[model samples]
Target: MEVNPLNIFFVKSDSKGDRLLFRYPYTTENKDESKQKKYGRHNPYAINSTEDLLQNPQSQTSNICKGQLSGFTDEMLSTLFAVKAELCNRKFELKVNDVRFVGHPTLLPYRTNKDDTATMILINIVFALQASASHSVVKCYYDLSKRLGKALRHEEKRCSYLTEEMKIMLAAHDEVSVLDSEMNGDNDDDDDNLRHSVSSATYSSENGADSSPKSAFHLILQRSSLARSMKSVFEELSSTGIVQVRINKWVLLSFCLPHKAHQIHNRGLIIEPETIDKCLQKLRPYHGILLMVNPNELLASIPLDSSSALLRLIKLYSPLKSLQTLAIEADLTLKQVSQLTGHLVYWAKATVIYPLCESNVYVVAPGANVHINSPLVEEFAKEFPGLCLLQ
Candidate 1:
């Protein structure tokens, strides 16, 4: 006979926390699970954020309970008991003599050393005895966004390496949204860092409620007033735990596209090259060119002298080994940027993947050189900063 597939469910609760529900089928239910008395609270669905556990929980002192609420909802525990029940039939229970599944959960959010503070979680669930007795068991997990208490099971999601480019892309989209909201008179006091907001107070009473737990302050947050380019990519690096630029010394260079060159000329951020040098010095520790993907493009021109000056400054002060990827278009017809292009394509290990423009795609092997242009000028060079020599 075919077996029912075990399933898991996850729900993020209005940004404040998470609600994770789980269930699966088993050949035999454990004696231990049968003994678990129901929690008598009326709103059992109340989410428990990280703060709830770090601050308060009835079972806080218990090591087993602590283990269950770790960053991930001891997702493995469900599988362990399920697999055991399958193998041992009626005899399978947690804390059994021989556990069949010793391996870890396939999905883990936090790495070994990093601190994971994904707080405020919700897990709504129920279990019951099956009609037949091949020791058969059935479990269910429900999503809150779906029908009330109705189990909604899905195959576990598979995602990896939240890339630096992804971070920038997300930031860019969010920045535009925030800008639109600001224009539309959206209050500065809207949501927190992760876009979570708490609800207002309401009294409960059948016979005219008395005012108790009197409300004090209602706090809300506005979007941070920081430029996306200036939001400190280092903090982003810390959060994502992966880097944007992988610098290789010998291949480092800098160039401007076109319009930004006009911007520099008309509304220059710096009056003289010394001011520019100062800005570069401030960014020197980062060991890379300060860049925008579509800089000089669409503009008039950037004097070769500026590019020459920037290159000399980069070669001298910037971390020589920590430079690659220039964020400008190819405009200059001086020497062949082909060598730079070749190095970028082959050695730099860069593939020009489009996030939103995912319309047309071909899967290339990892560390593959994907060149979209011919031996001449690259067309979509802006999107593929992973390639193209400085203009």
Candidate 2:
């Protein structure tokens, strides 16, 4: 997904007329005339979902337009426009190119989530919606979705955007987990260990009743260098062939192949094609309806040169798919699609369902997708750590 900065404008009116002056801090030019022709005035970067339009009417305009936009609080909005008008009156440079001025989005609605994990997940979704570029938001969402899956231990709903149902589910899941732990006589250490092992980030103690999750998310986001962090994670995985996982953080960085496991340390664990099939059998009841996993993450991997062809293929068969079926739908030889799935299946990168080691088939967990609770999945997570589930 792309992360383009939106434009900002100052609207001024005198007795004679009204004038609109603008500045764009984050703008990208499409060098290819043909590509530009494809989108024209319509910026294809933004996804115009109904949820988006309802929340913010100004979102109807392209990010290139600079009057008013979403993702800003009322105070920030007033202050920014005031600054723009002042700058215009003084004939100073009216265009500000920095992201520093952009404030956090509205927080009250999303803070309804019961805990920090759910709250953070919701904030990330709002950020994705308000973010400028598509790819960057995609990356952000991809990582957040993984965190959500781990935190809630659910596969049916990964992306917890403005959806109220997900919030309720997450709260309920938390309650049930607590109840189960208490009933099972699990101690605080056990709970802490489980949370520590899976969480992406440690919850800050400073989050009081008055404090906002939206603000907390923005703080972490601002402090974070996501692109650099992503690059480092990618490089570390590529070079060392070792994936270190610390949940609640964006970079769990898990990736390993079946053959590669031997190079590291052997747990005497061997996953055959049949083992994968059995796992699929277990997961079939829940998530087998889909052909492919998360297409956004899969499509994120395709290079710009091959993206069009890959995207065409993805559109044709981007659903719950087995390797053989996808090959037929994509009109590609089985060998080609198999190779594609192999690259994508790493560390649950683009998947909602667990993938067989180096296979094109995928399956969602019956409840939480973690391997620790299930004998089969626990075996996988133990072996792979941060990547594919063991079961």
Candidate 3:
């Protein structure tokens, strides 16, 4: 399954304080810049933004719970920064009102200025997932968050990217605050009451109302490079299990979501050297071959620069061509061809079988299930339209 995240938040904490620097699917009530005036200072949810209510379709279904998520995120700041030093650089998890937040919190050394040498800053990349998400799914997202955290740390150390971005975001917040104050004017009392009412109603509800005000403060992040990267990562990873994002023209981050395991293998299983030799002996260059599965996905999981040879080999592969024949056609050596086929089998991309021929004999295993009325009968008929199941 693809990784579907409700939201991805980048939280940073330093000597000053903790703040959410960026969040993906930068949400706001108003999609039009002209509507910016509609959102009063008391109601923080009002903003002029490019995106609609939510960009992610999967996340749109949870629109009703946006307020709960907002409140939970506010509460998460303290929880994320309050952890002991022992818990740093580890996965942090929290569940509230059916939403699960998984984050990797790491403390990295940051050079304060030209004068000061350096100091440690706590930063976390958090992924919001559904409560009923499977263990493997959660694990996949957690792994992604951990990788992102590490990448951010590396970039921060290299060129102070995180620090510069934070400064920009904070400046935006300050500017927005000033504008809000000017627009608010003498209506401060009325706005304060409205704000109080909104906050109180949002936190007290069961289904969770739209906690707009708190989220309004974060609208400044909509134009940030980090926010754009987060949106790209979420959309690409959710649609295809792989994503490549370039940050600040400094580093290119490529990640492939690990395949989910359906069944556990035997931990005690072992193969002796003689058994290995026998298997290798059976794998001969004279044997005809065909790919059991499509090689496109396997190719996508590898580096882009190294996929040309594999692509050529797969294009030339056929049941009629022996391994040696394929090597000659693909302009590769016999050893290289053999090793590629072995890698395919080891990675479950293909299966070694006797080449199909008129003289080849086929038999059913003793343990094979041959139930005539089973669902497999229909599936088999659909797969091979002219073939009889019994034959």
lDDT of 3: 0.63
lDDT of 2 by residue, 156-245 (tens): 234333334333333433433443344334646866657543431322333334221222222332333332233333344334333344
Stretches of candidate 1 exceeding 4 Å from the true structure: 1-235, 238-367, 371-391
lDDT of each: 0.25, 0.36, 0.63
| lDDT of candidate 3 over 108-148, digit per residue (tens) | 88777777488888878887777766675677677778887
State which candidate, 1 or 2, has the greater TM-score: 2
* Superposed Cα deviation of residue 143, candidate 2 (Å): 24
lDDT of 1 by residue, 23-46 (tens): 221111232232233323456688
Q: Which stretches of candidate 3 lie over 4 Å from their true place?
A: 1-3, 29-82, 186-222, 258-391
lDDT of 1 at 117: 39
Which residue segments of model 2 deviate by more than 4 Å?
Answer: 1-293, 307-309, 318-322, 350-391
Q: Give the number of colliding residue pairs in candidate 3.
A: 0
Task: Locate the minimum summed-lDDT window of 10 residues in model 2.
Answer: 120-129
Cα lDDT over the full model 1: 0.25
Among these predictions, the greatest TM-score belongs to 3
Candidate 1 vs candidate 2, lDDT winner = 2
